[model samples]
Target chain A: MADPLVIRGVSIDDTFAEAFPMRGARIILTAVNARWARIAAHTMTGFATSVIGCKCEAAIERELGPEDTPDGRPGVSVLFFTPDSASLQQRLIERVGQTILTCPTTACFDGLPDAPERMPVGKALRVFGDGYQSSKVFGGTRYWRIPVMEGEFLIQEDMGKVKGIGGGNFLILAETAEVALAAAEAAVEAMAGMPGVILPFPGGIVRSGSKVGAKRYKTMIASTNDAYAPTLRPITTSDLPDGVNSVQEIVLDGLDAPSISAAMRAGIDAACRLGVIRITAGNYGGKLGPHHFYLRQIMGQPTA
Target chain B: MTDRITITFDTLPSGGEGLELDGITPDRLLTLSNAEIAKLPVWMGRRSVPLGDIAAIQGELSAHLRFEGDLARAEGVGAGMASGVLDVTGSVGDGAGVAMRGGSLRIGGSAGMRLGAALPGASRGMLGGEIVVTGSVGAEAGAYARRGLIVVRGDVGDSAARGLIAGTLVVFGRVGADAGTGNKRGSIVVLGSTAVPPTYRFACVYRPTVLRVLFGYLRRAYSIPVADRFVAGRWKRYCGDISELGKGELLTWAEA
Candidate 1:
């Protein structure tokens, strides 16, 4: 009906999406202009590709308006998430203290105001000045002024922490690495800067998306998801159809269900193009994680 | 109830014990259960009593605490409070925030002399913290304050900051003469006008940048009402205590 919607003649699969709960915070980075803003944001989010080994997962949430920021300048909002408030607080302090505070024209604020658990991220970090630091309270929130070489650096006293969703994703099976990469890039480009969504993967593509556990390594918690691997088609119960020679996956983390759903919808629709095969999701038979997003349901159809 | 043990006197003490708060930091007491706070120690007239001996404890040891009843004879209400909100529902005796490091102490009524001032033999008063008195203060509201803030919403007596080391004091009502007689570094922001001492020399007529920082602190921390002029108007800066460090300043409001 729509050019048969085939990438290398591999049928375009239909399914919904899924996600899980996690804690999240937003870090805003600013500089003299967009260039510095991007630089700080990039460095802050660097090496934090996934929560699997990083202990915390993060990505750029969006670009903020000058009027929307504290210093009235261009800024980027980065969402970071962990399993708990304590670790979340620690991670925020470590990251912001190293990245945003050291960067010029930058200040940090609690992105989630509605969170019940208020953390003293700034209050604890104020001790860096030994005894010279001074504090000013504005609107009942205290801000610490630590003298730096350039001038005084002001940071909000507390940051808000809230629960969010993690591990929302979909897979794109293509006929070749070029098609897979191009499609993954397009899907990433489609979802880039989408509100409340973050693609926390290298170049927004993951070739090593894993299944729950390993068949060979007894101690391994996860191993390669070999179902969609083209090379394993002849040796294993391959999920890839004929002519679907390669695949790449896009993983998303977001503030909530609707955000993941929105990003998934945008990404899947964009991937349904030339040289694209079927689209599917990764899950453990619906036994784990509370959230479930069926591909067909996300494609505006009833789940089978 | 609050984790902090507050004692309200059933009977006022005749002799001044001069309560000391060197050991009490709000952080240590704020989150304890009631059973936990009953064990802390405080001095009675000449003897020591458990904190549970006087005031009835209520609420949890939250970041905020409110103590009611007359404390006119009670000294050291918020002495040594490091961090947390301490609200005295009535008048307090003296030596509040003596050598205080940080936190806030708000008194609903008058405060005795040496409130937020240094204890005897000590070089400085409150090292850091904010003491706000809603009613009149006896004398030396912020004397020898090294670094902190003291605000008197009411009238203050004479020799407010005698030998003040460095800090800030904002008096909304009348400030008695010889307010900043000290010869050191500090600032006195007087919203109410009074005769300046001859020892002080007029420095400049400019709005102080510190006012922006101080006003913001007042509005946010204590919920104090701030007038537009105070935040936007010019100030008359008098630099003196020249006999000492000569670093002190008295920033009076300049009339339009």
Candidate 2:
């Protein structure tokens, strides 16, 4: 790595985060209060970490005020990411039907109302009302009102589909696990609340970073990145330089490449605290995905 | 080039039989010049006269429009209109926005009978659009509407929203008797009392989620004076006319 550039005494590697295109959607979940809205959002986004097993990736984007919502209520914006448009739509319908509809005084709306492509998520869920559901159109958008036990659950007839970029990641190399954890936490705190980007991993940090395809298990699609594993430093052609004993990855999924790059810049800047050996990113030699988020360029450092 | 269209007749003789201007719409007027619009044919009693004989037209029709005249005898002022803004500076006659598909029609003064009602034998009226009347309206306003909204700031005549299929009619003032008489499915919302048809039954007195949304929209979009009480207040929903399909509703703003 040609003499990495340093940001605040920390070396920034000349690497890039590879991101693949994923279909996603933004949905608004509103309720009588913010608490219930949050509960519905959290319940809906639970277990939706990775597309490999969970079939989708989702997280809460932000909390919206009453004036920001269509129904003038407290709302939470949630984003769902999947490999394709069809799966993304199906996952949204399934999750919204089960969680948001079941929640008390909760209503769902389309966050990406201007997007051209639409998925009939609320339309599909309207059948649960058993023919008693009614729809109303305002400002050219249709909203379905389904009568539930608690009250009426209102949802938009369709949610917009957006072409998004997922799997944008950067690996933070540190001298110890404590430094790594501290740096990851700092990064997460910095990247929180940034629009158009979401840190899908737990607490915005991933301990078990995976590499494409396994070494021994041929059937497995992904395996641990042994190169960055401190335990396998001696056994593998370890990418961890000397004194780098621990590594943590920050995985981001965003609506666009620029969003991911912007978040990564903020995150990497925060992670450049003391004891941080270096900041690098994960990529498959520029072959895996279409979007390449260069570390140094994102940090606004001059190129060599 | 003028950015808007304005047709002014100042004062036409009242109680004329059927002075029709149904062909004159914002979208249609935009494609014609002042002279061309002036030459457009309009029925005046038994004789068809060019529009210039009565009204003085000015400006090219663009995004917004203005109609200044006493046209209480006029018929179908903006019928089948699909787009653009047509603001009637004075009172209009029957079928002001008959069978309109889209766009907005705002009337500054009281309107005559059949305001936004279907044609003589048509099944539906005012398919998709918005109508805001600042003054009172005569009988059968928003009758047989398929889908759209009508917000009348003043009192309404009898049979408002009668047989409404599916849409919303919000009357901020008093409504005459037999509102939503045989409505199959739709909403007739009144702020004050209305002569309830016996065929209708009281359902519940609760706040509807859609009303809050629609009221907010009306307050913001059209600057309609939708009070906070109406937005936050309870409404007495009376489902009627059970004598028909029994899906329509008349929601009176509960004073208590």
Candidate 3:
């Protein structure tokens, strides 16, 4: 058997987290004030928790100051992920047109200007102007101005898309449910506002960890992860330790590996508090994914 | 300072009509030796003269060039310029920067008539690049600008932006009469006083996001002075040249 590992008075599992390839885009939403920017961001990122159910995943990466935006307005930066480039473009046009363009005092701009792939979202949305839309170029970039009843809605003509990583995750095991929830919340707070990563979940914690497929239902693509379910410990080959009664899993999506690694290091460090039984990761034995993040190797490093 | 070609007028043209030096940009001059460059022909009235006979040429061959002394009699100073920097210390005669494709032309002094206007026969003017005149410009500035930018720090004479196809013309000082009379799909941003022609109809008073970017660029790139009121204030939009396409706009700064 392999030897065990411990860090800051907690056990560290040797397994790695496996992540798959995904397409990502970064968008900036600016409004007259921070409140409207946040509103547009939240509304656009809603109903987008997982690609399996929603065809995409998204969340607010951070709130930006006026200096960070092109128009000198309070802004918010959001990240989105999908399985491919075409799917990403569809989601961007649909969500931005329905949520951001309709929002008062809100304007959208491309966040990742250096990405190789560019999608023409603003040009597609310009039809809302009904032949009255106009475009102007500034500093070599084109921006579309659509006339609205309240005023004008300005958006960049293109959005930059880049290949990214999705399903980077870690699990927290604790002796009780209360302790596990508290540790997960602390870890989420530590990962908040990370520049290149987004936690596309409610409260940044997922209690319903899923597996690849169901045992009896052949049509189901995924089922409950019984191995980590504390109630299934005595009936199945459970991965939980003897004293563990609760588990909390955190999943992250990022523009690059370094960003996800940096976020994982901070989150794991914060989750290694009192009453925690062990820290581990979810994976498929390195068979399904090309990117593997080894827990022990990551924890030993000083920084990402 | 990779050797800038400096052209100084040690003596003026005998007739004061000056020589025409348009085809000889720094880029073109870099291909020739100093002796070959000095032998290049410059037209004065109906006759051609060697450049060495009229002006003193110094410095190594490079893309940056400077002109000193009075050039108000000189014609076609930067006509059809492709790329690189050309600076003029004194005034330039008519047809300055006509049909300019790309690069920058900065005039420290005023420019005569037909500045950046269309060629005598050709249709378009000031194809793609920037022209910054620190002082005033003569009539018909950017007459047929197709795609480019022109910033005038001082006042402009009559009929500015006439026959405009598409581009931007910004003036920080007063603009003379009959502006945007035949414009189509272009923009005239006036920060100073100007009589709005009767053909242009009032659109609205609003802040344009594109102007914020342009004004910022002017302030940084050319050090053009911009007041805070224009940056944070609203503008009265006017759609002009109803006889033409009527898509062109004349944006005037709205006062409080």
Candidate 4:
């Protein structure tokens, strides 16, 4: 019986964002300093935007303090997600070897130590030492030391994998492109560094949001979301209102449902400001994914 | 409440013919009553005798098994034990923890030869579990061990970690001659100074990140005295047993 809650001048949608299950693994990289740690992390996560083409999606989870790392050095934690554990393992070995191992004074450790499922990434990479690699067991976990040109590179024998949620997304409809960009920035700022979640897109905002299938091409898996396009509003079915002229999206991937919900709540709250016409979510009729984050419910409003 | 069962020697055997007390582990006794445990048979020399004939038994089954008095004639004390804690206040005979699968064995006094070593015909020794010795152990400690950990706070006799196939052996004191000989795969971390065998080829001196996790675990789990210098120091890695797989390593503490 309560009236719909409104923040600033923007209206909150009643739809929910559908999220699919993904296999994820967290890798912790430590370096001599924070600068090299970030360099390795950024290189490892590069080109890993979506599983559609990159075969995996990865992002820097957070910057870890020296005490947080195994070697007591500055470190960065990265979260990688794939459709399954096999693919997750494959991408982990390929990325960690090419980026982390190649970086100066960097060592890789498993971030998800408590996860039951494990993948032998370092075990596979140990061959790079060409029979020179040695392993050490500390506490109970095993780590492999590979002799690199720059001293030695140490990595955990196995990385832990767990089931995570991906493709939790929302769209921002605004009266102008500038307004939409500002709102997206504000939403990203609000949701930055939230635990168990990562905004995979660049700057945590996506401009080219896509629909499930192509309009004309049968082979195309996805096409531009023409319904939200201001230019195509006259030709196609426009989901936008009269004053809405621009739209951008924020896609989220998290370790669980609660994390996505918490992030969405904070992001939507920051986005529901002046010039933003409405806040809506992307979903496939709640049929594809098991997790659904209702916009209004997350904003503390009763669902219709 | 003290849930542990204490067993003290009531009548000490005269000879050193070795007693097979493999069944006296904590996990095996956890289900038995005091009388039932006392009736358990232990092989002495060529004959079997009731455990109560040699030791005074008290308390019911618990997570811990405490043994008092010198057990220097007790061989296979915790062999093949899968779980629980075995605390020995005195020295034990040879093959004390041979072929153990899991659990922890802590010895306060010296141990005889082949501590945590393989059984007579078994391919591997101490497949899983941990053995901690506060006093020096005799020859061939952790020989042919496939997996698990063995920590020696005192000097280790000759041929330590011989034919090791994937496991860890940490010697806080001096490692005797011929240590890590013919080891296929495993790690031998020596904190005290010792002569390296010619078979081991010096690889490099570097700090291993795994030791941080391991040292931290040892410091917290067993309250083992881990020097900050050794925990945070570089180690001289030597790949050895070239006559075998040459995959095993000997990491000697270099500096703080």
Candidate 5:
């Protein structure tokens, strides 16, 4: 069998995917229930779209149960990454202070427990209240309690920062929007709540894809991937086949390489149902992101 | 390696303006680029001055520092120090080392009230740094110290080391009344007899190995004399502040 798997007439590139080292920290936001957890995660991960513009990139890694949380409440784990440790700490302090501290019943914890590098997040955010905050140490971790009018807000003293991989993705091409969306949804649902993997987009789908740079704007680093847009098929170098009409992509970020690959495998298999014309991926010709996930090798091929 | 300066108010001088110690941070100043350091707000009397206004800075790029001065009236020293060291040479004023973390501090003299205590509305104190005071400390020393070390060598005022969590504090002197009031996982070592709060229970009477390490560090780093009796003596372990986590322990030296 060839190294890259070709499924449904689509090429599963055989090249070994490359990944890079990035500073990442997981923030666990515990709220009263799933609703509050979502709120805190959304706010904490907001304005953190890309490291280029926002100085950090973050998303909800997964939803955790009451048993999975430190405080025995429903929570969400957010993965935040930056280029360096100092930037990571500063960004975390800004984001968590604005997001989790203001949210009701939200308590933040470090998700990367084993990483030796520790960044002080709550250590900086504790000054919002000036002098009324308290602290508690449980299970070898110190948590800060910032008093608010509603009650108390708890945050971990130091968050573990580790080298993580970002920008892992796959594409789903289907005959109709329904099929594309369904497949994307299925993929997201399957990967949802999985440890260390986060779908950073709304509903885990990216519709406005991009190429390396804008065609006209020299300063724009990226623009639309018109080559893949079904509408631009007539004028652009459309990669769509004869029957494919719609496409949606799933972008994943993880604490490690294997996690992204595993989640991709699960998501791709679930998306390979009826009306799904093909599956592919997005990469910078294997130049930008250090991690690469070739499709065919991830899924076992049927013997000839 | 820390650039944060720790200024203690040596005295109010009855009618004089409150003393300010703004020149002795070691960490925050080191790590910050010159431009960054120029922006940090330090106080002189009631007016605000850039960090460059007072102290002459030295050292290469670093994120930790030490302060050596009499700071009895210096308020807000290390007030918003994110991560650094602030060693004080003399007694500090109220709110010394307030809201500090990610580094350490060694205070040679006494700290005024609220040493390592939380900021006005903050619930945590000295989030992730070490605060070592060789002399007696005022009330609420190490109050709400979240996850670091706070060492006081002399007698403390009331409510010393209260609301501590997961940090280690060693008091070579007698701890004041109401020590460890709401502590969670902090280990307080009192060299003198201390009245155990109702929340603490006597766990055992044994010598801890960590004390030797602590004493060694004190002697080497701060030049504080480590008495052999206290370092090698048996300690009465009282596992208390259970009202919080039941994880914190108080190790008071037993009568030799």
Candidate 6:
């Protein structure tokens, strides 16, 4: 099958990464300046690494220009995903309340203004103003102005929710930890600022790739991916090559299938550099997720 | 197939009874032929007259309906219209847009009393839609309005927004006395000078972000002349009608 088409000495696996459906919402946080906007965004996305423990997965989608925001201020776009819309609304209210509302000179708006499904995130938080809260409808959209310790906090009345795909991932296998880290960084840099896709891990790199369930612990929903562990080569069913010493994963969540596919192309292309041994994907057969992004097909190579 | 239907006054009706032309809205005429539109009845001085007898009908109805000539004796020009655009290039009588539910009504000239105001026996006025008057308007412009927007480019008479429930009224010119006496929940923005009622308590002066959005929309959608100073200026807020719900507000331009 075309000799398994190698690019820059790195083998591309034919397998695909399985991504499941997730409920997602995009929030736009604007501030007096970029620094404060970033501060609020980072704080709101904090403790939201994965739905396994955090009940949600969130990350900064991208930095938005003034023209891209509703209030014409420096802004940041963030995406939050949960198992359902109910949990998504709960997490959004709690995080937006604890972060953007408390941050100085920060205002929040709905990034997905055209989505049909809406959740009242700001309406739930307006009670913080007690009897002093006021609402204004501009351009047919309602916004609540709450009197905060600062001047005022303006938040859109409703945040939109849509069905998205999550857990699209690929494993970067390299000969050393440093090589794996460099490749992961290059992959993240390539995929950064891509519209509708987010890498939720720290610096867009996941050191602890996980499997579906624990080996012995029945209560644990997930445990470490032992097959790819170099240290467990002798004890476990190792999936690593002979010279591979380290592996790092890049997990992606996106609004749709095409966005994840485009991001995977960019990441895989940038990661096929020197010291990277091979590129593979994580999947639990083909039953869990409806979307399957095959590496070889995405790279424009025929699959066997 | 013309996109607009023009109705020009062939013989201006002269009387104090005032003509009730409520059914001549753009939405109602959109699907009717010119012959059918002429057959629609309009009340004139206690007598029902065909629309073709008073006005010269031309063009087929579509999204826009244009009225030409002076209509100072014509009442309810766009009353109860729910959708489409109604453009009047002449002065209109009282209740120009009374009890309107949706759509936009643009008057190129002056209007009589109770523009966009609630009809008699009705608790609420316009539920939605927008009205723009380029000339002066008479008293009680948006009285008891539930939800809508009214922009007046000229002066307004006394009691402009009496008993307003919830909506926005922006007056670019001078306003007479008792502008918002018993408003329960609404906003009256006076770009020009206005006499503030004693019942309203002065609130803080700040630049609301929503104003910028509204100004931007007005400039883009209706081609209204929005001064740069108003777009960037701060407004002095006054909360009032304490005798009622005490939720209404009057925002006046502090400078520029």
- How far is B51's C-alpha from truth in model 3 (Å)? 6.8
Writing each residue's lDDT as its tens digit, candidate 2 over A1-304 gives 3456888788988878888999988888888889998999899999988998899999988899999887778999988899998898889888998988899888888989789999999999999988777777766778788877766788889999999999998889999999999999999999888888888878888999999999999999999999999999889999999999899999999998888888998999999988999888889999879898888889886556
Off by over 4 Å in 5: A1-20, A47-49, A52-54, A134-140, A301-304, B1-256
Candidate 3 ranges with C-alpha deviation above 4 Å? A1-5, A301-304, B1-15, B19-21, B24-78, B82-93, B103-109
Error (Å) of candidate 6 at residue A281 is: 1.1
- lDDT at A295, model 2: 89
Off by over 4 Å in 1: A1-14, B1-256
Give one digit per residue, the lDDT tens place, for model 1 in B1-256: 4445454435445555544333444566777777666666767667777766665665556766666775687677777677887777788887776777778888989888788888789887878878888888878878888877889988888888877777778899898878888747677889887678777899778654346446755776678897868865788978778887676778899953
How well does each candidate reproduce the native contacts, as fnat? 0.03, 0.30, 0.17, 0.43, 0.00, 0.10
DockQ per candidate? 0.06, 0.56, 0.41, 0.38, 0.02, 0.36
Q: Rate the local accuracy (lDDT) of all candidates.
A: 0.75, 0.86, 0.87, 0.88, 0.72, 0.90
Better TM-score candidate (1, 2) = 2
Q: Write the per-residue lDDT of candidate 3 for residues B1-256, one digit (tens) a residue.
A: 3478888876574576566878767667766777777898989877898888878888656788788888887888888888777888888888888888877788888887767778998888888777889889889998988877888888989999999888778998999989888898788999998999998999999887667667766776778778878876799999877889888889999963
Give the better candidate number (1 or 2) by DockQ: 2
- Each model's TM-score, in the order given? 0.59, 0.95, 0.88, 0.88, 0.56, 0.92
A23-93: candidate 1 lDDT, tens digit per residue:
88876655557777887888788777776788788888888875566544577889988866678888888
Candidate 6 wrong stretches, greater than 4 Å: B1-18, B30-35, B56-64, B89-91
TM-score of the A chain in candidate 1: the value is 0.92
Q: Using lDDT, rank the candidates from best to worst.
A: 6, 4, 3, 2, 1, 5
Best by TM-score: 2
For residues A64-148, what per-residue lDDT tens digits would candidate 6 score against the true structure? 9877777667899999999787999999999999988899888999989899999999999999999778787655788888877
Give the i-RMS of model 5 in Å: 13.2
Question: DockQ (C-alpha) of model 1?
Answer: 0.06
Which of 1 and 5 is the better model by lDDT?
A: 1
* Candidate 6 lDDT tens digits, B79-166: 9998888999978999999998878999999988899899999999887889999999999999989888999999999999998888
Residue A133, model 2: Cα distance from true site in angstroms: 1.6
Q: Between candidates 2 and 5, name the one with more favorable TM-score.
A: 2
Residue A292 miss distance in model 2 (angstroms):
0.7
